[model samples]
Target: MTLALSVDGLSVWYGEERAVHSVALEVPVGKVLALIGETGSGKSSVALAAARLLPPRARMEGRVLVAGEEMSALSGAQLRRLRGEKVGFVTQDALAGLNPVMRVGRQIAEVFQFHRNLNRRESAARAVESIEQVRIPEPAAVARLYPHQLSGGMRQRIMIAIALALRPPVVIADEPTTALDVSTQADILRLVRELCAELGTGILWITHDMGVVAEVADLVAVMYAGRIVEHGHAASVFDRQQHPYTRALLRTLHDMRAGQPGDPLFQIEGQPPSLNTVITGCPFHPRCPMATSLCATEEPVSQRFGGLEGTESGLVACHHLGDQAGAMT
Candidate 1:
């Protein structure tokens, strides 16, 4: 299968402070790779940089390959052509991402206009088709309404419709289901999974919710302190987590294991390190339960246990993997 996106040695800096380390990832065609981490762990920074969407003051290094283009080397016009045409982006907050003043249908049509050079009638028809594809009720009516006039879920579906209108090879969904009710969230996720599969679109799903990853992700890459601490198949990563951080995040989930009603939730001790602080060894050591002198002064080597690349079961980064049988799920 062809990979929709690939990042090699990707790193980003805000002035002298580094926000992302040498992070490498791949999202194969029709698969979702979840970039999981708590806030400030630099997962979003990595995803945004993959699309050349980082902030103005941020400096980036390494290669981001997508849609037959090297993102890091693209010229201004070429970069614009790549986004929304070959690489679509779905932001977290639909209400914020869409213009309140613009009619929903017109906004979706703009994507067709930019990439397809379609006339207004053609764009409008295609936009309604997209709205229908996303399963919105009465596409024609929704098309005429402004963003605020729709429910949160409707607005989100509209956003997804815009992304799908171009049939991009890859879609970057940054918490697209956030701020929605539980039922709405499920609908949005199902829509994304179904639409991407139908279109053969690779997805980079960035979220802090392990439950979301469990339900939708084919592969998982756990990020902490600007670096990937563990990456593997979603099943193995959760069933036999090799890194302390991955285990900690899993234990924090509400449904992972049975606990007393009065018991406090499990949480990783200590705070995530600030970007201003530099560490020579594993950045997570301070919060990791298995930290040692080696963890404090040296980087952990990545170990691949599987033969097939991108299979999701054969990888980990750690100095203390312990006995696999006894490791926390």
Candidate 2:
């Protein structure tokens, strides 16, 4: 499959604070790569960096390639053009993303105005179409409503409508269903997956939900602190987890044993270290149960597991994979 987005040694800093560290990954055309991690794990930071939407205080390094172009090197104008035309983002908070004062239709129409060069009438028609495409009932009526008028799920669908309005080659959805109810979350995930598949759009889905990851992700990248700790086929990573952090995350999801009392929910002990602090070893070592002297002093390089290359699939960063089962205490 052709690579839609490639990130190499990508790092980001907020003034003097480092938020992302040497993160690398690839998203192939028509694939869903779920960037999974808890809060402050740098998942959303990676997405924002890819879209060139980071705040002015952020200083970036390394490469972010979108459809073969070096995104990190693009001029401001070029980045804006690329962002709406080639890559679209549905942010975690739908309410914050939309303009509360503008009618939803006008907001959707703006996509056509900016990217498609459509006149007022044409853009209005297209906006209605976009609204319908997202399965909003009575598109015309809904179009006239402002952001504050819609339910959380409806607002999120509107966000999706705007995102897919341009048919961009890549889409980044950060915590796409965070505030919705469970039923609504399921519907939103289904809509996102179906739409992306139909459009053959590469999707970078950033979320902390393991259930959502299992449902929609083709591949998974587990982030810890500011780095990718494990990445692989979703099934492989969830079913045959290699990294201790990854294993700990999955173990928290359900009872590992069917009949017996399942292990207690394993919580990583400490808070994520401050970004301003200089990390000398595995950032997760402080919270990890299996931490050894080596873990405290040395950061493990990402290596292929399940017999594959780093770029191909099945990658992990940890010192004791061979001893994982026994390491969990």
Model 1 misplacement above 4 A: 176-178, 255-266, 309-312, 322-329
* Ten contiguous residues with the weakest lDDT in model 1: 256-265
Tell me the lDDT of model 2 at 17.
86
Residue-pair clashes, model 1: 3
- Evaluated at residue 144, the lDDT of candidate 2 is 96
What overall lDDT, based on C-alpha atoms, would model 2 receive against the true structure? 0.83
Please give, for residues 80-188, the per-residue lDDT of candidate 1 as tens digits.
8878877788787777789999999999988888889999999999999999999998999889999989988898899889877788889987874336655577668
Query: What does candidate 1 score in Cα RMSD to the true structure?
Result: 3.2
- Per-prediction TM-score: 0.92, 0.91
Report the lDDT tens digits of candidate 2 across residue range 143-249.
99999999999998999898888888888888653476556776887788888889888889886567777888889999988999998888888877878788778
lDDT (C-alpha, whole model) for all candidates: 0.82, 0.83
> Candidate 2 at residue 14, lDDT?
91
